[model samples]
Target: MTKEWMNWYRETLLIDAHNDVVSKMKDGGLDFCQRQSATHSDLPRLLEAGVNLQVLALFAPPDSNKSVTLQRILSYAEYALDCVDRDPRLHLVLTKRDLEALSPAEGKLGVILGVEGGDCVGEELWILRLLYRLGVRLLTITWSNRNALADGIWEKDTRGGLTSFGKEVIKEMEALGMIIDVSHLAPAGFWDIAEVAAGPFIASHSNAAAVCPHPRNLSDEQIRCVADRGGVVGVNFYGPHLTEFGSASIDDIIRHIEHLWNVAGEDHVGLGTDYDGMDIVPRELEDVTCLPRLVEKLRQRGHSESRLEKFMGGNFLRVFKTVLPD
Candidate 1:
């Protein structure tokens, strides 16, 4: 048998469900193909970090305090796709096969193009179809503020439910086989989606509200809600999300994982470390390469190797496999 050390650092594929690498890459004055990384993640760093799948968000913060036009919206997605298409190393993915095709040597990283907010398309459903056709696999209904699609966690959800247009958007995404992401949706919007989204969905980069009082997390009921629908909640590793005082360490991250796993069951819990998206991370999980530390920690916490494997990668992969279109 191989030494325990040999299998200890298992080549488990790490997938951070949300990363702002594309935009930050742009900020570093590097385009997709040209991104050499002066910042958090680059192609080389991702490989060094032992990542299998990296979700690159097409985030274009509105130029105005409120970006109220379709023309200005989706520019980031359009450009990000162009960047991906230009780089043979990056493959835009909308289906499971696209993910299966990734090769590190080829610099071919699996990129699931996701829009952070549906504000770009306004109330029109056609834009979703266009975005899907453009290779977007996931859509977060809202970001920090309310929009035509849904209310964001930052905003007070006066409506207390999904709007009529939001329901229609969900249907379109369902028909198109796109995954509905609820990271920033308000409580009302969250439940509204649970009722309408036909297929299972995910909170791509959210934590348990019980762990952190942040508006961005799923409440205990919300956690159960997503799990009941066969969806996974990728427990976030952001320091703020994992700690109640917002004072945290990697241990806090583990607590949330253990908590979510215990509450949501093994199959429905996974990691969605919102790298680059959050300013603060647990001290132990400082960089991508430090992920193995988390595995060892989980082992100490009485999580069997099998459970660790599932929590680390298997769960997210399962969700992705289930949600990807035929």
Candidate 2:
């Protein structure tokens, strides 16, 4: 990498909207504070990659009962807190002020807690409130299955959208300053959210369906809707989402970014590499430290410094600033 891009990358406020390291910690006893050769990211690797902010997801298997799911989420939250407490360089981000306090030069990794599915919320708004009080600032309404809130991408046969409860939950989330993630929501549910949401929302870790034709990827219209709402579509680095053949490399990642740039505009593009959440990742992007290579490739593709900055992290920071509480 050239010195110019490297310097620019270091100075930029890099943010990833989604990661599953917390769940990995909960289930596999993965150490977040130490460098782990088995996982995609850890404290040392994230610092080396220059990631200023990382949103760790609290996810439970969709099939688990409400009680089990709630317990699992709480356990993950506790573990994440423990990890933060164990590492002086890691801080939990709760408000806009906390986010603004992050500086790449300080080598502090600010963590924003989020939930990958709303099943833990069950039919109660208080559970959601509890999560907020616990420092969860983002929630994805569904995973890949139907829940009390709405149907997921795999529920297309049902043609289900948001339940009345789902609409209420979203309104409550916005009022509580929690970001709404629409990554695994079905098309019907995605449109329902667009209709009900009064503020910007994000597809936290999804790619472009127009490029890879995967259910987990968003369509051009979906991308446009997110951009129109002043929201962002985080490019997912998972292989299947990036290529039809289920194998991908850095070039495939660039293809998705290019498509998102054209369809969603520069302001709506960001990185949400679902690291530690997937089994397979794109070649050359096997871990967090490879992020600079991705940016270098974009630079080679003629992306100007300002545009590359947006794609790298600026877009998500703008949305977080807008959506997160003061």
Q: Which candidate is the best by lDDT?
A: 2
Candidate 1 local distance difference test against the native: 0.74
Residues 1-326, candidate 1, lDDT per residue (tens digit)? Answer: 24573354435555668777676765556755543635556666666666667777777664343344354345666667777667666666778777666543343467788888888867678778888888888888888777888888777547555789999999988888888888888888888899898778899889887877777777889898888998888776677777767667878888788778878998888877777677776787766667667777778768787887677667777777788787
RMSD of each: 2.9, 0.9
Residue 165's lDDT in candidate 2 = 97
TM-score of 2: 0.98
Best by TM-score: 2
Residue pairs whose backbone atoms clash in candidate 1: none
True-vs-predicted CA distance for residue 193, candidate 2, Å = 0.6
Q: For model 2, how does the per-residue alpha-carbon lDDT over 197-297 read when each residue is reduced to its tens digit?
A: 99999999999998999998998999999999999999888888989899899999999999999998899999999999999988999999999999998
Task: Give Cα-based local distance difference scores for all models.
Answer: 0.74, 0.92
